[model samples]
Target: MNFDERRPIDILETIGEIIEAAREENNLLKLEESIDILSTLIDNARFNQREIGILNYFLANVWSYIQRIKFPDEEFPLETPELEKQIIHLRIANRLLKDTNDNFKKCQIQTNLGNLFSHIGRFSEAQEYFNQCLEIDQNFEMAIGNRGFGLYYYARVVFDATQQFIFMQYARKDLLNAIASNQVYNEAKYAFAGMVKQIESAYPLKELNDFKKYKDFYKKLDKKEINYKKWSAENKLFINPLNDILTESVVAHDYLFIPTMILKSDDKLFFHSMFNQLKQEFVSVRFLFYESVNSPKPHFSDKEVVLMDTLDYSDYSFTLEKIKIAFRVCYSIFDKISYFINIYLNLGLDKNRVSFRTVWYNNLDKNKGLNTKLLTTKNWAMRGLFWLSKDLHEKEFDTTIDPDAKEIATIRNFIEHKSFKIINSFNETWTKKTETFEIDRQLFYDKTFKLLKLSRSALMYLSFLVYDEERKKSIEQSNELTIPVNFLKIKDADKI
Candidate 1:
């Protein structure tokens, strides 16, 4: 542990060797010691992006092994801050290695990210990370197998037949592909074997004609017989385009809109309205963001007063203004989702005090973790939203899902209460303590886009959470004779 005379890279390598040896020998105590040293090194040492990435990647792997060693008899706690530390480390590694030339390491980090998210029951994000891994290395067996494995769990928890069938068919294909690859991974073979047994034991899905048709539909997609782009564009569905950065997120969001019949209830009306509002707000923000990036001219109303003191003249443009609006509005949507949770769940917290960062806890006590209502609901999507909220909260010195979460939070605060500026230059000269939080226009734009993706995920999770609850209600009240209620779809002509 004494690395006083060693270079940072040397220290990192030493720790990696120690951790690997410990893992190979099953030395729990030595592994725990290696974890502590690596954490200390990460906190205290100064290293370039590549070195730090390697360090975090090693730490994440060691922590995963430690968790399995410690909890041999049970699944890792789905909502624990302790378990999320592994996620934080892997995400940090992923961000740091984003531009690295090492394709194998890139694939590894992404695969670990997917695995952690799946282990914690955040299957939506898990699938996205897996998709990202496969994008980097399409034939990566681990990513393929893990994605299939995650989908099986995802299919189990979901209540819709369409979702279940789609996930299972894809899962089967990925698992088979993983198994049939030239270099077979043992884990993939094990997963496929386990999956086969489970499906064969409970072979009810194939009996449904509707689900059988869904399998064929997926086959057509695989065979390229169906033009997905044409189908999606014609139907106005937000399907994933190939190689899109937001492909998985878009796919997840599209699935949330699949038609489902629910009995009429007062809460249903309110929930539906909130879902609509969230969707509209998200779409508006998304449009404004793209418009800002794509617009050629700055449009302004002549009636608006031009005050020199009110603007940062250094980089003043309508595009920047539009981007700022998108960022602020996108940030607000998270709190609005929190408001929805408070009212819908009847948490009875003070309405004005509810926040996305604090709404899930009992009396804002994060130590108590999520409230009993959320825990009892048994909805994975709701739990996923709770975990997503953690990414936006102020973590002091801790690592958040977004490496720049603290700065993003500061920018949001300044935009609302003080001054926030977007400049072309971002260098060491800018002080963090300044009243104006200045950032480069490109960085600001990137963060805003990231926030939009996060907001999209939050909205999707909210919709699915409601869907899960509605399905549960229908099942519980199956014998009740409820009156039929019809709802009309909002056409393009109905847009405001």
Candidate 2:
């Protein structure tokens, strides 16, 4: 962590920023990492009361924030041991700062407590704390937004339209007031954006004639001003969209059809690299996917009901081909990187004295080849990619496998092993409650696409590292690389 090189507060602030990003992005890896770092700091750092209080506050609240976002429709009853630990941290922070006169800090704790209470359906206790925060300071911008968000979340589970309308009316007002109180604060803007979304698309409140006035809150402004689209994109793409999660019967209607890239059109490297053949193959698969989505065969009446996956592909053979090719693509990427690193490791050695060919011929673990043991398994390969590209230790990166993405390893394993385990057998049924040997095609395609995307991203990133390292080695050996006439590319015959 280079802890001695950085100030303690700077480290703490960085951790706080990471935690906030996790909440905004719903990144479980980032959230878990921020918690681990904070927990370590609390146990190890010799901080004073205020710093400790701050650490405890973050340790407690970040978990609650994630749970609230992940399962907003239901109460996060503080029954789980994890939630209980967060509550303990909040309680510790509360007691630590009780004697202090930090109104803002006290108000934050109060709001957090209110949030926990509301999550557990203790509405009266939740209201008491929110009212206490407002009583502490009527203009506390965060507390104001907190009340608005709390109301917005509460309105999710409430049934009556009249009750929802009333709660939303107050929420919109509090969110607006919070923005007015702090024009530059991101929290206020985000809360205001949430309020706008709920009024427009999230809930069926359009018929409330009185609620139409709330449309002025967003106004005919530029789309970027409210950043509603940006928030929605973050919700889906940052992590997997969880709208249908937290329920077994959820029918996912949202899908990333064709999975377009967000890169600029002028970025030639995506299509013009030495691995252009594999890139084109991947793109071909995407085109097949596009065709599958647009194809029509069956028609159903409005009365008909059939369980269907929103994200699906009809081209099963081609989908499997894409996955197998993605594995080869991932292997090629690490192989190139490993080759360059091995070259760099032998840079200063005397080839004539030790016979570089002898070292090269040996199948060392670090050898840059597909068959090398450096990252023999898919799990190791995933972790190894980060190590090659990043200057940080593997421990420092948030490297937990996403639940959806973890299936990538199993599919890859079955592909490498040619096992029918990828498909369920009749014996694998869930105690005969459902049909046996059913394949979750949605899960298969989703995970395979994840591996494809993961390999591409890691390949592109490590390619730059390989290019620069080889360039550095060429320069060290006093052989300047020849530059391409048109594109100004550098090619060193001596470099990998």
lDDT of 2 by residue, 1-496 (tens): 4455676688778777878888888787777777778878887656678778888889887777666666687643323444555556776787688777777888889887776655543332354467677777777777777677767765543334555666666667667777676432785587577675766574454453354322233345575433432332322211111211111112121221111122233444432244334444444443343333334543233225444542322223433444455554443443444443454344333333322122222343123432232222222222324332321112222322222323444444445654422232223333233322224545554544444444344443333334333344444533433432123333547335
lDDT by residue for model 1 (1-496), tens? 5888888868877787888889888788997787778777777747778778888898888877777787777555556544676778888888888998878988999988887776655666678788888878898988888888888877775666655666666677677777787666676688686885675565454642233321223343543224443333232324221111222322322435423555445325566677778778877776677677766666674237564753333477677787898899889999999998898777988789888988888886566666888777577888888778878855432446656788789889988899777776565556464967788888888899888777877776777777677667666746645654455677768786
Task: Give each model a TM-score.
Answer: 0.82, 0.32
Worst 10 residues of 2 by lDDT: 244-253
Model 1 TM-score on a 0 to 1 scale: 0.82
Global CA lDDT computed for model 2: 0.48
lDDT of each: 0.71, 0.48
Best by lDDT: 1
What are the clashing pairs of model 2?
A: none
